[model samples]
Target: MTEVSKITLIGHSGWGPVEEAYEERLTVSAAEVTYRYHPIKATAENVAHRWRYWTDGPALVNAFENLAAVVSTW
Candidate 1:
């Protein structure tokens, strides 16, 4: 049996509309798409902190693992 490909998308809460539009265009793909939303403010400090948290958090780590698994099959 063949394994379905998967994709992960990480973005700020404010980009919901854009993300939705992008997702809509992906409807014909066989790949599974998963989204991870993070709250971020306009200030530089807030933006930096949120990005740091996202990159170091457990959820992102798992996402990387999932990505690695998919790449291994190619």
Candidate 2:
């Protein structure tokens, strides 16, 4: 398995933080990529759902690609 970098995706919409853990892991492919992406909501799911509206189509893919590129450079 490859190493994945954990990143916190925070935003006012709330989806960012909730999806941070999964997204970071998926993006980095690391085992223990811990992220603390939190929105105004108390539940992680709430924050994650926000991502639905915050990002659509290529936005998420583009963001993930950009993050992977930056990490590879580092």
Which numbered prediction scores highest in lDDT against the true structure? 2
**In model 1, where do residues sit more than 4 Å from their true spots?**
1-54
Clashes of each: 0, 8
**Candidate 2: TM-score?**
0.28
Question: Residue by residue across 1-74, what tens digits does model 1's lDDT show?
Answer: 45434343433333444323221111111223333323232343222221112234566556656765675577
lDDT of 1: 0.37
Per residue, candidate 2 scores C-alpha lDDT tens digits across 1-74 of 34434444433442445433332111122222233434344454544322222334565556666676676566
What is candidate 1's TM-score against the reference? 0.28
- Which regions of candidate 2 fall more than 4 Å away from where they truly are? 1-56
Worst 10-residue lDDT window, candidate 1? 22-31
